[model samples]
Target: MATLICEASGDWEKAKCVIKDCGSLKSVSDGSVSLDSSATTFGSTATVSCSVGYVPKAEKITCKESGVWEEAQCIIKDCGSLPSISDGSVRLDSTATTFGSTATVSCNIGYDPSVATIRCQASGAWDIAACTIKDCGTLPSISDGSMRLDSTTTTFGSTATVSCNIGYDPSVATIRCQASGAWDLAACTIKDCGTLPSISDGSVRLDSTTTTFGSTATVSCNVGYDPSVATIRCQASGAWDLAACTIKDCGTLPSISDGSVRLDSTTTTFGSTATVSCNVGYDPSVATIRCQASGAWDLAACTIKDCGTLPSISDGSMRLDSTTTTFGSTATVSYNVGYDPSVATIRCQASGAWDLAACTIKDCGTLPSISDGSVRLDSTTTTFGSTATVSCNVGYDPSVATIRCQASGAWDLAACTIKDCGTLPSISDGSVRLDSTTTTFGSTATVSCNVGYDPSVATIRCQASGAWDLAACTIKDCGTLPSISDGSMRLDSTTTTFGSTATVSCNVGYDPSVATIRCQASGAWDLAACTIKDCGTLPSISDGSVRLDSTTTTFGSTATVSCNVGYDPSVATIRCQASGAWD
Candidate 1:
């Protein structure tokens, strides 16, 4: 083989060898050459070259001119990169290595340490997509064994267990754990009745209940708890209910039925009095009574006693008080008892109940009768709702009374001065108002039209204050003007009709009083007109004077007359005398 001729130098000898011209070329004519490719070799230092797009593997290759070309070793290299760790936050999880070296992942403490060590894949990425997370086993409950998880999830459910701290009691909470594998966290609610439970004083409860952790558990009280206001509940988790029921409303005994009884109040208060009365044929044993501590009351237990023994005012009864009353009267019996206005009871005896109906109650005298307007009293002891109907002769307010009936069964007169005015009314014409100082159960009210009067629109009415709500006066007394019957003459009905009427009588105990009568035009009947003769004018009534029965008349009578009530008979008859003239 001949020596090769070199053309280039520097880095490596600029060499261009042609093995075809010289067989098995062994050497080059330049500096020593190195084999470019691993597949070639030469006997001595020879010029070598690498293929296009490839660099010599050894930086320097050799080729020999031996009539055979020296091989130029070439190799493809991979791009360099960093060893990736599973957690990018912990980039240095593996030892440093070459471009294609493999890396693995590791975890810090508190962690499973070896959950899933990530592997650096061929893509130079430590992908954790293939790793699985391990979850904690079902946690045991901390509260009473009543807690259960709905599902093994990291959330809550509809129902939950509410546990009170060691020293607490709570009502059943509003959450629970179902069969789903989830956690139900319920807010703990504690309840405790500040006072004991009860019943009588409206203070106790009969069947109060309580609850505990969410489970099947119930709470209850004895016959009556000291605190009726306290509330109790039960739990579904079988745990004691935690919350003590709070006071909501007072428990009330069923209402008692007596004569038109009126209960004093509708408040949460207990032991308020309710007075009872009877209708026409009915009779109440007692009246003017107060409610007992047990919410029970006696009828007509205030003034006169019907115990079959001598009556005494001071009994252990709650109704007995320093008030006047009138019991059954025999007229002849004197020393029995005085007129006890406090005696609230005026009812028929049991056997006589259906016989003679109860007499009409005078707001100031007796309870109203079947002939009179209706009455609605509250509880046998309570006067709050006590009401009486004093029907004017006619066309007057039925709710008006010369006096009103009180829980005490006492007739009360209007407090206003006698100016033909009715009860003091609270007018809300947005302007008109009453300027009178009246205070009392039956005090009357006086009102005038708005300062700027509107004659055609003057309307007035009085109502009771401090009532459960507002209520118009009961048993308005006879109006200044009398309402003539349909066929009768009238002075004046004077005011709005309250289904009231009045009974006028002449001076003669047996004589009938003649005056204009009125009624609410409704069921109001002028019972005020008696069944017989009326007395004549004041100055000329001869004793024992007899006239036709025209002086006395029934309701709805058509008679022209002008006469005051209770006058001696100048000429007795059914017709009323005009002024001093009797025709």
Candidate 2:
């Protein structure tokens, strides 16, 4: 019968035998063959088990009766634990996950320690770790809304009110704090907000105060504005401040948009055209025409250098009759310097058979010729397209002249015809039409641009005769591009093939967009210059440029990039943009 060869054979090679029947014995627990000093053969059995956390050798055991050594089997283990996270948290319970047990963690209510992560071990013990995370936010500031808030802001999550410091109306008059700790508006609305008071800061509100003669409150005003009516605290302050019309702003003056006027008085001269229209009641057709500046009007025809054409003589003025006068007949009176404003005078004859012309050719004087200057005519009788050339006796470039004359036997008074034409008007994208042959200061010189040229660039002004000034123009339409989305990538791979997930995005912040771009088909490559942005306000550059590969919420970070010849970073140098947006 077969007997037990070796109960447990691990160390010694030889074993004792209680030999029996036809077969041999084998061990599953731990097995091995053994050899004795007597060189005798014996049946043996070997059994084996492995270290603690490791799986032991397989089920079979090896035994050699004829003195041969059998092979051994076992495997080592590496099973790693939980990994570290970006938030500084750690996890360890990966072992014994075999049949799988559950794992758990917690952040004590009060201890709000950043993170609390844990994993279950083979022994069922849980290993927990702590980590830290940061929170980001903004400051209490007004945006481009109903409030003209100061862009200056404190930190994120603060508060502010709506009051334009000075010279501005509060777009929104009130504001409140929000949950995010930042200042926001529950409701924004318009109130009786006039422009900023023309007073110093910190001044109290005078809305409830009454208006009295001499009584006044300091006030602040907006740009381009000034007090048209003085505020006076007359009797005990009664009604709110009130304003009234004063004649000081009105006179023989041209009506400036019916109320607002440039206070420079008596500026009208002969040929100075100003329209006459009265308020609703006053009949404009029956209104008396007079010189705006001096109140001196032409009872006779006002003098002009050379009426581009003959002045259309109206009623009760000079006429070209024999006993009447022939316009350019015998003594034609003309002035060449410092002339009086045009005025009409009635020549009371013995027989009141009224003869009317702009002015009398007989009361006129001889015209003193001028070169590059004006020749004021005494009568309304005139010709068009007249030329006067002026030259200095010596060597001065003052090549200028002046001509004026008072109508009706008044001495040949020269008029205010200035001949100092400093510079010639220059032509640009557009052309110009000088109102007079003699271009003067403050003349309205209208300049137009070419079809595609931008007009808001510069205003045209005529000095004297001719001088063209250069105006820097804003960018017109040249070319532009739209925002493009090339999308993203997981890793810059061996075949940086911009795989299915690779993304690229480009959006212009300026007016002109990018044109075209291309890239070669190799692995891990840079861009082929998609397109360049046009610079300048004229060019209209897009505010935000472009982004790519990953997401980035940082400011001014450009995704389009070029690496320095030798610079290499662990992560892709090109960063994605962070759309600075929050709820």
Candidate 3:
């Protein structure tokens, strides 16, 4: 047997004998641990003891030779009964009240809780708390009134009474605190006085239909009457201030020079009228006067018998016979250069009014006509400053485009003259002809081009100025002809002009269906283009072979016939013709 060497570990280092121990047990929350023997070595035993309201996981544990104690721990104990509340009940989150458990308190309708929830602590006890009644803030104030609280406490279900001051009424007599911790609506309003006061010969207007305090009433008298006070207020006592309206009176009518007064009514009180009349040719300032609401009569007066100066006439002058504009006065009238007067004199009428004369604009006769043109008037009447528009013939123009009627009853001198576009411009291959004998304004001319030639413009006109509007005649020629495939073309004329012709000729293996084409007046060939004529493929002959001179069998293409061994064709060779046939 081999001798074994042993080494001490964990709390047994350097000891004479191997001494094992379950190192001091870790303390458990709310619990304690104690060993059976003071010395902790192999086979030692220990007991787990928990604090009040706590329990141990295992009652006893032993230490092993390895210096380790058996697994042991302390757990939280059950907490008995939930917390109490004054005005509430408890609601547990779960039936279990072990560690980390929670419970909530619900207050009665009008109560509240101090804390929302109570939790079971690690000590196996619930946190201390209670529920109490809720409180509401201060009472609401009333406008124009006083409020008195009925209950000493401002909690839910509390109430207050309202009292309005003098001249005001309470909207509600009582108010209460709501469960939401707020007061009900409460208010007071000013008192209202009934209808406004009535008055004789006048009317009263109130600021509002309701005659409440601070309301105003305006007093207005009827015609010919005056009010003692214009406005009054409703007093706090619910009554309007005193006001009165009385009839107005005016004194006697006044006298006027050169005038006589006649009273329309017997009495001179309000609304009385008086008429004033002046001597012949004299006028009263006012026809009648009446007693006004201000307790006085309106002014009445009469002055000298004369008419005011005559109003000035447009484009005319007037001279008064005398310095005064009295009756029987006369004034002479004179017209401006372009004006005419209806009458030569103006007379003052007996009614103290002037008989005015009117001045009219002078009229000019119809406009004069031009040799080869016409004129049209722009205005309905031929009065001064009116204008006439001149229009010339196709070959003429106006010397002066417009003319006006003079102020002296004459028309302005204007005419449409014949244009003198000197001689017609010459053209290379064309000739021009004058339609009129003279080359003045309104003259017309025509241009003619020889065959195969064209003029830029067919006609010419003498412009508004002395010069004529003319254009040169250019030579007319057709554009290039379309190309011919496998063929060539030859022009009948040197230039491709109208009536010109082109002839098409095909190569040895092609032919043209239409040998010739003509150039049209539109500067294009009558035919689109020339094409080669095809004779179709050669016929197959039995026992004989055929050889073609070219790949194509069109137009002049040829084919050689041969005998195979002992066979011979009817014809030795064949040729493609221009008529789309083989011969």
Candidate 4:
């Protein structure tokens, strides 16, 4: 028996082992190696193999009993050359391919490889599919806009552009196709501007509420105000253009001659008014001056005025205080003795007329004498509208105290008469007496009544109508006498005249309490002697009791009697008569 020991050399040192040589073995190259042990030494065989992607052909060797080995040869299996691909290319480890060899595939720019790697097979061919061009999916859709491309087919390194409609813009300008089989997309958005600016004393009007680029706004003011700016524009940078709207103002008002002006406000403004007023003795030509929209005031003026000539007077000399009869001028007039003018002075008015009425002269006659009174005048010679004072003697009085001169050239004597009294009148039942023989106005007369008569009025007087006021003295009469119980009276006469006396007497069996009565001057009777006397107590009874009807035994009273048990009665009843006695 022969033994074989295989040793590794060169790049195949890891596969070194003992084996028996088979004469039919071939070569190996970086792949699996095998041995045919049936034809080799028993229980001492060795083989060599190659790794993946390499072919191996083992060497045929012999082993001897003396522990020595013979050298052998190894060969590699061969595979064909690599094939070409459309729009692609292949790369191989060597130009001459072998078993278990590999080849890589790749595409051109903007292209992708379908198979990345391949290997050589034992049938002398490559284990790989054909390479194809890469494809990027369809381009993404853009919002509010659209994308522009050369073709619908999307490939690697291909570019597309994005665009927006009116009032819109794109987020990005352009996009490119990638090797990852996808295309990048850029979005689109709407363009906008910021809020609009505000204006003072005015308002803005816009075409629409939306504030955007290239928009316009118009400004306007209130009724009494005007705007400084009329229009404004919106800018592209999301902001509005600079604008200022203010109130319009007019300048100071003009001065007016001979007049003063009053303004609504210190500062002149649109629609304001200035009122013009003239001083004393002047007038305004225009009433008001108003501010207009053109920043100007209405024209106004003031003017002066004058009066005409003065009035003339009859029977009086006139004098002018000023050279001309202009406004605020005066004039005077004077009259002769015993004559007076109706007006004393005259003045000129601003309405071109004199302030004095027509003046006339008049005279007054001589003063009149009084009978029992004296008259005194303000002047010895009197004129119209003059006054005089009148007085009477110490015991007399005048009907009127003062008098005046009339327009008829005579004094007024209607209230200038002197007062006097006439003879005293007689009184009935009385004598009239006077203090003095001279009986005039305000004189009084005293009266004396006769005996037993009274005077109705105590005095009499003389009146200004020349009539005497008479007074009466009346005869006095007394009233009827008072009645006395159980008595009788007799008068001297039926008429109860003053100074008349009456006699009184009680009834039978009664005494007289008063003797006589008299009448007084006051129409009343004297009651001192008009009383009646009372009767004494009734007689007492012993056997039979007595019961008096009245408490006492006065006039017109009665008593009753009763007997005890079967005794005879002395009297049943007894009466007290008007004479104060019991019957």
Task: Quote model 2's TM-score.
Answer: 0.21
lDDT of 1 by residue, 1-583 (tens): 4454554563444556543232243433222244333344443333454443234444443344543544445442332344333322223344543223333444332123342444444443443422222333354354432444345543323344444564344444434433243434443343333333223323323243432332222234332223322444333333332333222333442444434656666643334555565653344665445544444554451222232222433311123222322233211111112122333433323333211212222233444452323444333422322444344322223434433455444644422221233434343432233434634333333433332232223333332332211323233333444333322333344543444444454432233335545554332445443333333442233333332434433222223323455555442333333322334
Candidate 4 residues 480-548, lDDT tens each? 777776677789778788888888877664565658778877667776433333557777776777788
| TM-scores of all predicted structures | 0.19, 0.21, 0.42, 0.30
Residue-pair clashes per candidate, as listed? 157, 98, 7, 23
| RMSD for each of the candidates | 44.4, 43.3, 13.8, 40.7
lDDT string, candidate 3, 1-583, tens digits = 3344455643433435666877876566677778887867778888998776567888988888788988778777777788677778888999899877899878887776777888888677888777565677787776788888897988888888999888887888888877777778878878776788888779899867778888898999898777999998988787888888877778788788888888898877787888989887778999998888777877777766677878788888889988888888999999877788999988888788888688899888777877778889997888999998988876666788888898888888766555577887776778888998877766778988876667788888777677877677665577787787777788987878788898877776554678788877556786634567788878676888778888988777899998788776889888888678887
* Highest-TM-score candidate: 3
> Which ranges of candidate 4 are over 4 A from the true structure?
1-219, 222-224, 228-246, 252-264, 273-284, 300-302, 308-430, 434-446, 449-583
Clash count, predicted structure 2: 98
Off by over 4 Å in 1: 1-261, 264-270, 273-290, 294-583
Candidate 2 per-residue lDDT, tens place, 405-488, comes to: 343333332323433435545555565555555454544445566544555534555434434344432324322122334322
Q: Which rank order by lDDT, best down to worst?
A: 3, 4, 1, 2
Candidate 4 lDDT: 0.68
lDDT of 4 at 6: 58
Clash number for candidate 4: 23
Q: Regarding TM-score, does 1 or 2 come out ahead? A: 2
Error of 2 at 206 (Å): 13
